[model samples]
Target: MDVLTTQTLSGVQTSIEIAGTVAFALSGVMEAARKKLDAVGVCAVASVAAFGGGTLRDVLLDRRPLFWIEQSWYLWSVLGLCIAAMVLMRAKHFKPTEKSMQWPDALGLGLFAASGTQIALGLQMPALIAVLMGVITATFGGVLRDIVCNEIPTAFHDHHPYAVCAFAGGWVVVVLHYLGFYPNAVVAIGAATVTLLRLAALQFEWRLPTWKIED
Candidate 1:
């Protein structure tokens, strides 16, 4: 790849990461608000939700310095976002609903899925591992968020396609890259595919088969 192409890919990935962070942070804010948490609680929850999955991925990949630490600006951006969101919610008297959180969560799922898979691929990981990294990056943060909020992780219990969507989308990234699609295009399409599939599942009330135990 040319230097220009590499730089462009980096830019696209960074943009996706930032957007995913914001989406996850907003979802955290909504969840914390639903639990009626105070300012410190809200910021802590949002930070964890925004960074947990990516941090875990970096650990698993043995990437030193971590993504957020290497890109220290992300920390300040998340902090600013949390403060602004809190101010707006209070000033507008915005009542958060569980439903409101899902939209941003879906968006974050897609964005992180693509970025994570691409990053793993860049490291020459196996395709399967890359896809799993994508799934982890997309879903683990929400798992942490829900656990911190004292609820079952929606991805596990909602009876809807959550991680499944990320799984499929991760394959999309793998296939596109293998087919020689440009990095930016691959990322965008993969992310869009996951986000649309998730939104569609929600809109259509799609269900996954649930386990039934005999009483």
Candidate 2:
């Protein structure tokens, strides 16, 4: 686990991010179930919300065979998570207790973002593009979720430094990698740092400014 947590953003650390993606995907399933969405609907929402950004990034970069496509397990794992979530929901009436989910979801965001950034670098992408990939990986799913729920995306109003933290941490890993640090460890630190900071922000109800314009 320490080694897993300490790697820089390489395919070597992709397993960690993949696990995080599964967790995030499961959360989406739980959310859909909470809304009493049907089986297909739940899976549909989870699939798009979980893997949307990564899929798009792969396509844009002309990453042949695609990220999930190459690793059949990636798609299978997401399906497995969705199935498990559905089964769990059916077994016990699904409800968000407010305590169980908040932190894991936040942590997952950090992990996925760092993972995405690393993957981009591994593909030899430019730093700006890699950072954008990280942001998308970390944040776009939540945006899709919000739209499905008919709410504003969380980051638009600066509810917290959600994407900012991910962006910074992903870049931290990338920079450290370029500076000769072991990719695996640096990535682990960056991802974990983002997770901790984000969780802390949520824990303390910390948020950025909400500007109001009045005529």
Candidate 3:
């Protein structure tokens, strides 16, 4: 795309990342509260969900001392958010929805997948490995959230379209890059693809088929 479109793409990617972080973090905290988890549990789940995927990707890619640790600001930002959400939630329990949060989870999932894949490609990681890292970075936190709360790891199951969304987003970035799209455009295209597919999948009840064994 042209310079303006590329710039717009970058903005979209960044916004999605921040929003995804906030949305997932909020989800973790809200769930924790619903389960009657303690304050520490609430904060821990929120923080972990916010940064867990990035941390795992950084470690896999051998990028230290990790994304949130290196940046530091993300920690504070998450903390501030948890505090605000806690106050609002204590006043009254608010359930998360697409209308309120505007699908930050899907948005963030796409961005992280694109971002992780790009960083891996830059480091010369194998394309397959890079895509795996992208998905891990995009969804591991949600997986951890489910596990910590004693639920099935959502990404590991056929419960919803979440994993496919992240995977499609990651692949979009890789495909666009191969087609000579710049990092910015590729990132936006990937995010949009993931988010769109995810929402569509939900609306239409699309899902990967479960294996069947005939006796």
Q: Number of backbone collisions per candidate, in order?
A: 0, 8, 0
What are the models' TM-scores? 0.88, 0.82, 0.88
Query: What does candidate 3 score on TM?
Result: 0.88
Stretches > 4 Å off in candidate 3: 1-12, 98-102, 213-215
Pairs in clash, predicted candidate 3 = none
lDDT by residue for model 1 (1-215), tens: 32343467666556666777888988888889889999998988998889989889999999878878977988899889889989988899875566876776777899889878988888899999999999999989888999999999977987899899999999999999999998888888999999999999999998997789999
Shift in Å, residue 112, candidate 3: 1.1
lDDT of 2 by residue, 51-151 (tens): 77677767777766766677678778778777877777678866556577666666677787777787788778889888888888788876786678566
State the RMSD for candidate 2. Answer: 4.1
Q: Write the per-residue lDDT of candidate 3 for residues 1-215, one digit (tens) a residue.
A: 32344245555455667898898898788778777898888889998788888888887778877768777988898888888888887787655664665467767777777777777776777778878888898889888887888988767885677876777777777788889886677777777887888778877888787788899
Local accuracy by lDDT, each model: 0.86, 0.73, 0.78
- Flag the better candidate by lDDT, 1 or 3: 1
What is candidate 2's CA lDDT for residue 66? 63
> Which residue runs of candidate 2 sit more than 4 Å off their true CA positions?
1-15, 94-96, 148-150
Q: In model 1, where is the ten-residue run with the lowest total lDDT? A: 1-10
